[model samples]
Target: MTSYNASLRARLMPIGLLLIAMSCIQGGASLATSLFPAVGPATATSLRLIMAALILWAIFRPWRWRVARRDWRDLLLYGIAMGSMNFLLYQAINHIPLGIAVALEFTGPLGVALWSSKSRFDLLWIAIAIAGLAVLLGLDHGNSDHTINLTGVLCALGAGGCWAAYILFGQRAGEVNGMQSAVWGITIAAVVIAPIGLVNAAPAITESHVLLIALCVALLSTALPYTLEMVALPRLPTQTFGTLMSLEPAFGALSGLLFLGQALSLLQWLAIMAVVTASIGTTVTGRSAEPIEAPYPD
Candidate 1:
């Protein structure tokens, strides 16, 4: 009985780690919003990528690692997707609530989950995801309000699209060296994003407080959570990991409410849940789903 209990505990611990990782990521995103006004989303994104790269370099010492010439292509695409995903999502949360943005972004993964499905069962999940998106876009029942920011919605969807690309390419890149691929991806993301962001927000980028907040965002959203996820990855099945990650939108919503005071309506909450359900449904049944290793919505 004791041994059985120990086994149960071991199984559950990874889930706990994943939960904490998601929560930390959402909390980090909420915190990042506070900096959006001061430095703009572009600069904030640059800081996140740059700082995360530095942190990963320190820990992984990617300089010592050599990449296969064949793997470079996948790694390049993964980095582009990762950087673009972060930039677009930050643009998204700039105009809309974090929960809504996260829900919208989840469609990328949902679509990935359904990519090769010949299964009729997947249709129901697709319907759920579409319905959620429709409702959030205020397209259902032909009712959209001034409250909705179309640009934010579009950016979030784009971010989701990038996220799908990230997962597909990330799996390929991760095959060779595991999380060391992450260090490389992050370094590339920083290189790609820093110039664009710095060009846009030159004046505000140098403030001490901005640097501090960016550091915090880097730690909460990237460094700490990435470490936790790496630890949890081996312990859980891909299906279980995928299902648990579906909870991210809910955590994002709660973080917005708690830290950013972005209260969502009942209808919005339900829409987010619908997206989460679709994500969970598809990934639980999808043929090639896996845990996401990229940094989140920040």
Candidate 2:
């Protein structure tokens, strides 16, 4: 009985970690939205990256790991991609609800998954995803509130593109030490966003309460979730991991509702469910597929 329990725990541990990571990530996003009025979205994003980079550097000591010249290019691209993705996401949520923003942003990985696969079944999933997107975008005429901002949708799409780039670059970066690569990559991101954030929202960012909240966001959104994912990735089956991660839209919606008091219409909820289902279907059918690479602090 003892041995059986041990085995069961081992199997369940990764699932638990992934679930926790998803919750923390979405929760952090919702929390960051609350900070936007004070620090602005760009500054909040900068603070999160800066704090996360500091924490990861202290914990991982990535400087101790030597990188090859070729690896530097990969890391640089990875950082840029990650920074752009987060910045764009922050900009997006400023204009749209968290759930809608996340659903649209997920198109990046969904596109990548479909592109990488040659299977005919992938087309079916893609079609379903498109239908969902149409509904989400109010193209289906189901939305009474046609107040969705075009710029916000574009920003989310841009973030999705950045996310795709992050995934591509991360595959190469992962060839190095995982924790080290993450630390250095985030540091580079912090550097990239610092000037804009500091220039626009310096006073707010320097406030004691803002700094404290930023620290909490860094831990919840970046350090903790990333660490849990790193631990869980190797243990979980690729399909299982992909399916679980696809639930991020639902989690995002939940976080938005719980933390920000954001509500979604019935059609909007169904649209989110459709996209998630398509993602899961794509993942399950894709050949020997790795899970969608969650772009930093997802």
In model 2, which runs have C-alpha deviations exceeding 4 angstroms? Answer: 142-144, 288-296
Model 2 residue 81 CA deviation (Å) reads 0.2
Residue-wise lDDT of candidate 1 within 221-252, one digit each (tens)? 99989889888988988778888888988998
Model 2 lDDT tens row, 1-298? 9999999999999999999999999999988987899989999999999999999888888878899998999999989888999999999999999999999999988888888876779879988999999988989894467667988899998998988888888878878877777788899999998777878675676788999999999999999998898899889877798889789888998889889988998888999999999988888888734444543446
Q: Evaluate model 1: give its lDDT.
A: 0.86
Poorest 10 consecutive residues of model 1 by lDDT? 289-298
Q: Which of the numbered candidates is closest to the native, going by highest TM-score?
A: 2
**What lDDT would candidate 2 get against the real structure?**
0.87
- Of candidate 2, the 10-residue stretch with the lowest lDDT total is 288-297
TM-score, cand. 2? 0.95
Error of 2 at 246 (Å): 1.0
